[model samples]
Target: MADKRTTTPAGPSTSLQRGKACLRCRKRKMRCDGVKPACQQCTKAKKGDACEYDDGKGKTRTQLMREQIARLEARVKELEKSSSSSSHGSPPANLSLSASASPTPFPLDMDSSPWDSQWNGIPDFPAVNGITDSYATEDPPIELAQMLLEIFLPHRHQVGLEVHVGRLRDSLHLPLGEQRHPVLMNSIYLWACYLSRPGSLCEHEPLYLSRALAAVNDAVPNPSKVIDFIQASCLLSMYFLSNGRLLEGSYHASAAASLAIQWGLHQLGSTDLTVGVIPCDRESTFRLNPAKDAIEQGERVLAFWQVFNLDRCWSVALRRPATIPDSKHPWTSVITPWPQRMEDYETGELEINSGSPTIQAFFVHQAQVSPVVGGFSTFAHRVKASALFEGASRLSSSWYPRLSSSPSFTENFRAFEHTITRFTTTLLPLHQLAATLPDEKTSLLLIHSLAHASMIHLHQPFLEDQGSRETAVRAARSLAVVAKHISDTDYDYLDPFIGHCWVLGSEILASEIAQLQAAWSPHPASSELRVELNTLLFSLTKVAAKFPLFGYQATKVQKLLDAI
Candidate 1:
């Protein structure tokens, strides 16, 4: 080979050099032909737009991760400081003394409180119960807390626990010892844990719940903490109810109601200053000075409506007398202003002297004067409809059997029906057929479902009349249609209350089917009814797969269908 003419020396071997790759290539573990602006692999994969490179001055991925961990640890230490300080020594005796000094109209019996029994079966967390000082002083891991918060934010509005999101975020930035309300914080975490994805989180539900219970148990006896205590109790009530713990939920609900009354939330902005009047300057009868800022005032206003909405909704669900009745609690009838949007409070747009109309007057005056210009928010409208739904439920329960002889029942029913009809006609335009966004559509469907459900409930007791029977059947059909549409489409967002409407509507239809099948001769529309029932059941099963409570409901509906 040396003798061969100018044998070419072995050229440098063509080898791949381990050059720094673009971020996308590095993440994908691919070889990068390091090109400017875009890499070959990314371009070939049609992801050139996503291809990026780390500048020499920028930190590496590992370094960024470490920084995040450090921040989280700092937050945890802050949270721990408050707990550690409190646990190290007993709270001042003056705290209790000052609480007692305040004149509470209906004082809670601290000795034999109802909430004491409700906490029995909940397991104690070693960390929460102070088994070891170290555990008691530690805050929850940041990862777990973050996960829980993610689950809670989207669903809070559905349950009527819409606190100021901006304020909450800011609170997280403050030192742990400076956090505003421990009871509220614990309650928030408790519900977040309850709603977390199915796994170890489910096992920790009772632990968080116990922590909340302990906090509220302590806070209730202190007059200065009453407002925050009531807020926590209200959240706990819904949390229990959503988890199928009805008795505990009812107890907490009643407790919240009592505290709300004691704190004068029910009587806020009362026109008659003598009845349940808050201790404020007489000149400012229309506006209370209890709240120090717009955010606090907004929360107070929203809290009242939250409790009102729960009382009305659950009374119908449980078939029990409502704890806050309009006749006995004249404050319930007072025309307090509707709550402003959370953003308004955050931006300082809501003033103490803002002349917002009371919900009662809005319904009576604004609605009549400008039906199309409805001033109520979606939530406010939903609550208003809930009131009507509750009233219809109560009337049916009390007078269905005695309708033939009860003139008063007939008169009340007529008036209530008129009110509901007017309200339905006055719903916001966005809640009509014109809604375009997915969320708006879902909300519209919910409101309409509730309206129809209320109609079915109202007319079911009067089914002997052909007109009433037709109305019930029509409403039931409308509900089934909406439910089926929601399921068929990929509109996956539904509130807990929306599930309630589905179950109620299903019951009405199932009952009607059973009645028809029981008749001596089958009804002419039996075949059509069977088809509709099957369609509705299919929709329910599909939607149930998304929500745990709805899944339980679907199981019950399946059993009903099997029997039929």
Candidate 2:
């Protein structure tokens, strides 16, 4: 069969250049006026999210989204024809333009959203034949699906934040697609399988992953259901990253960001807060309606930050540019406030709703007063920390190789080091003030680890400087301290990215250990250094056993320890 395509919906006509357009235009078979970064057609159509040039390597982010959702829509269509499928169910809620006959454009104004019970009064309907339709082959029985969900819940933060876990748990009986959406349900299943490694249930990983992948775009056309895809994409991206699949991981990571943009999650509440957010859909073509409840609103906010955190940290992790640009770029402007904890939203304790430019403020050293640092929520800190790590990484030689001696590099270094100093010394209370649960403990460890690693990576090129080298030494020592605080249980709960994180400072530890071992009469503290090194290594060894994504990095870290 030939490829299916669509033209850009009609927009204001303007003078035509008649040259190459963006990959989005090319695929849509629209006329080309070839523009850079974003095309005029896309700009006018306000599809800045989908506008990107062809680098001639592979599919554009928009193409991937189209294909992913195309399959999902097909699946839904297939179910539509199934004699047994239900036809009475309602889509999540209405909000959007004529992007497709299926999804309407969102309005820019919040008060205008169709969120009242009058609009969404259609009662919830059970999915057709339960959740079985998501799978192409065998659908797991309800009993098995519940078990997998139980396995996933404990680790859902790593997949993507599940706002109102109780609600999710209670909704399991609602049928998979409506328990949220099949895309999200399947995404959780694959995570359960991945995290359940070495167990008999792990054998089902591929089945769930395939189903999850196929569900990618099912809700793209449904305004109310697109958040399901945004969230599932985030989970799927993390899954690939955990297994060390960088390209696909990066692909889906950006896909989540793209989906968020298309869904208007990025600029959520921008109009209400009067937060100078220039909408990606300038015409307010795809307005995100006010959420049905605070919990629902919290879900949208959480999804944006997860995508932001992934984009910021993983771009540095994968050594690529962030898909979510931080400049005042209208296309990618993120006006959403930093996220609050689930409890905060549930209890209406949303102090982080001021809505200034979050990433921008944090990077500009305005965090303390910028509403970002005000909320001491787990997610608030996590988001800011990733931005700091990304900021620090940008100054590292690893990100901009061959610029060590450049004047601009020297200037940027001071700012990066200053930010690290403020965070570690004044802002971030290093004490385990909030961590208790295994997951929380591991999360705090990851944040602390990233903070120290940021200093290490930034100071790497300045290793010849005594002060810079000692700063790195202190950071490495701090890494060991953080690692020791984590119990063995936290190892299973550790984020897969932390594996790469361990490799960062272990080499520094190895160097220090080697130096101490060579001394004929080492300092009394030398043995303690060895113990600290051993602690970090122990964590990595445990990690290697559990997470395949971390295995390669784990091996590298073990070799460093062995050589010493």
TM-score against truth, every candidate? 0.67, 0.69
lDDT of each: 0.60, 0.64
What are the clashing pairs of model 1?
none
Q: Cα RMSD (Å) per model?
A: 14.2, 23.4
lDDT, candidate 1, at 5: 45
Candidate 2 structure quality by residue, lDDT tens digits, 1-564: 223324545675664444334655655578867656677778886556446654444674334533543443344334434423343453211111122221101111223211111212322311222123333643445555666676677677755565677777676777544568777878887777566544434544555665776666566676667777788888877876666555566778887887777666676654343222245556766666566666777777888888888888888877778777666876666667778777677876544444466667766788787544354666677777788888787767554556757788778778878887777664335464322433455677788888888898887777767797788878888888887776544565677667666777787777766765777446576677678777777777787676555566566667777776
Error of 2 at 341 (Å): 1.2
Model 2, residue 56: C-alpha shift (Å): 60
lDDT of candidate 1 at residue 439, scale 0 to 100: 35
Candidate 2 clash figure, as a count: 12
Q: Which 10 consecutive positions of candidate 2 have the poorest summed lDDT?
A: 99-108
